[model samples]
Target: MEDFYPSRISEKPQIMKRRDPVIHTDRKHDHEAPLTKDQLDFYEENGFLQIENLFSDKEVAAMQKAIFELQESNSCVQSEKMIREPNSNEIRSIFAVDQDDDYFKDIAADQRLLDIVNHLLGSDVYVHQSRINYKPGFSGKEFNWHSDFETWHTEDGMPRMRALSMSIALSDNYVHNGPLMLVPGSHKYYVSCIGATPEDNYKESLKTQKVGVPDNDSLKWLVDQGGGLSVATGKAGTITIFESNTMHASTSNMTPYPRNNLFMVYNSVENKLVEPFAGAGERPEYIAVRKTTEPLGKEKILK
Candidate 1:
């Protein structure tokens, strides 16, 4: 494969470091007591945790309606493409909803969510990436395992910086329904430079040692080494949060029902959006629907 590694963001003087304009360090929203000592300890130890009932039944219902609408529109578009291209990687569609829309504004600004974010990050955290995953008809597709930072752009030697993602299910999640699988506490072992080879074809060379076995064997060994894959399963309103460095992916949805989930990515104000990857055009809906109450710098909000 051709080398596709992205160039690093240009660095500036040490005295005046440049940061992502979209990230803001201001705590505009009212913050309750951030993370209690126990909550912090819990996150530090476990790579992931489940926050049950993040959304109410009503909210979930509304989201379900919106998701179906989006899916219907997507199906029509893909169907047309199918006429020309018989083979396409477009087996499924995962959309980033409008961040500035009523759904996102309400959910992103939900005091409960803000409280949890404040707990994980400090009071001045910013909502970075918010998207919806819509898999139709038990598609035999999965989100391949990868680290978020690998796809990001930043000055060399920059800190990992606090980041978190909340995956909220809009339908009952199960192994068959493609519940997310996470390796426990794996983030602690992550290194910043996970072998900076070609971007798209980059394998996670950051492993401490070579995984000598075959794919299934290595996965089994990994499960044994990391206490096993955490299959987060639950009802529509449950949300699971984890560190950005945590290793995670999902299996093919095999159930008759569709699997839909919303993802909200959060990062500190200092993290810059790596253009072409994290910028608005990559997913315009995500950038446009963002509704922040406080000063968040020059973020690419999806309105």
Candidate 2:
């Protein structure tokens, strides 16, 4: 495969102008999408959009309940899907969460969210990845700044920058509780990192990523270009949507409050997986999601 955004083989980082389109569709007035022209325009300029209350309080409560049940069930504790904090047993993330949980599956298929994704991708989309991230007070760790597409493209064989992540806050995300921080226009530039991916890196990288991280210079450049960092902090039920290549990260939860969010990646059906650009090979299905590419809500769910 031709590698437009190559990494993991170079000894230095390179910044390449983004070659792919950020907005795949021209029809901005999507009835079910609920995004106005101004909102779409902002996303086009910034590569991310933060909606204050996309989900209702009742809906947020139900989502929180579902997550509580999942945690109690210990379904992912023994599997690779569950990523624990470096210092504690508390889970940092649960990968491929909807594969076994019907509640999350329904959330993934929910028309209210899918419409916006469909409009953005300009095509029917499928669940490329899904997870719930937990940041417990005091023990939680920092997720260093990096672009998710950097890892997904190199290790997971995601072809183009045609994917986007939709993260819905499940609890109050305060400025001090390690709220998500993103560089507004950073998605337009792809930072190719320097490092060879270790074999079976997923086992370790899930907790603290080392291979696909951007260098400090590149991060600073993005920040400088964007003027400063923009944070996503709001009450439960808020939604933050961003392009796959957008630079984002969160700090450790040092305060008493906790931050939890449900993250789902929607990939255009046209931009499917290929051979891995780096690493041992294709990552496990839990992380990259190759088996089930069926469009959510429209086609039959692949088992």
Candidate 3:
């Protein structure tokens, strides 16, 4: 198999210097708080954490309304990042929502989220990407098993797996609605995939309406090392944070209920992407962000 390369493969700087981790002590925001000992321990041991009811109903509803409006609008750029569902024309994912709208931008900078991310990363964080995934009832496609860091590192020029993903369910994530499934503690094994490259995977996803998955051998090895697969199911406000290297996937939504989730990826400021893989110019600002380390202020938080 040919070695996989990110979309844009110019002879630019391909690697970045990994930054040393440092504990952030200054908590300038009211919502900012350090993670408890148990919470930290659990994340370190399992590579993920599920925090129930992290957002209030009003907050969730407001975001849902915004997403619905975006979906209803016909003007959203139909880029590869804003992918459509396999069979139907409905959008399956909306990438870089933070850059596209103010409401999502604030959510991306929420102190409640940054505090935990800051603690885990032991340094300042920047939004690498923000997206809203729409798993429409009965029509939602499957997301094949894969590790996020693999793509970020190989395609986006992210130096290491110091980033993490936070997913907030906009609708109740039930087992029947194709909730995300993760392999516990799989972050320990950074499986170098051999099959489709990131660019090919994106093309195939557009064609098949499914995420590009890992090879069968890698999948089996990850499951064996991580113990098994676990589903993430919870109320609308529940939040889940997973390490960048964790292997995760979701099944097709066969039920009539929809599962919508907001996903944000925060990368350590010190580990910014070198160059986008997509092409000559920068990848769309909404897909892979230009690195900025300025911390989010309290004023950015939504009430």
Total clashing pairs for each candidate: 15, 0, 3
| Highest-scoring model, lDDT | 2
lDDT of 3 by residue, 1-303 (tens): 122333224333132212322222333331444676666667766789899767778898898898888877734665666777767778888888877778899898888888788767656788888889888898988877877776676656676667899999999998788999999877766555443344444456434523224557667776887788889999987899998877888888999999998999988776778754332334445667774545554533232
Which pairs clash inside model 2? none
TM-score of 2: 0.95
Q: Which segments of model 2 are wrong by more than 4 Å?
A: 27-33, 75-77, 299-303
Worst 10 residues of 2 by lDDT: 25-34
After superposing candidate 1, which stretches have Cα over 4 Å from the reference?
Answer: 1-39, 73-100, 153-159, 191-225, 274-303
Tens digit per residue, CA lDDT, model 2, 1-303: 898889888887999999898888754344435688888888988899988867778889999988867876774459778887887677778888878788899999898788788888878899999999877777778888889998999898888999999999998988999999999899999999998989998888878888898999999999999889998988998999999999998888899898888999999988888888886888999888888998877643222
* C-alpha lDDT of all candidate models, in order: 0.51, 0.86, 0.71
Weakest ten-residue segment in model 1 by summed lDDT: 13-22
Error of 3 at 124 (Å): 1.1
Best-to-worst order by TM-score is 2, 3, 1
TM-scores, one per candidate: 0.65, 0.95, 0.81
lDDT of 1 by residue, 71-113 (tens): 5656556431111111244423333343435666566667777
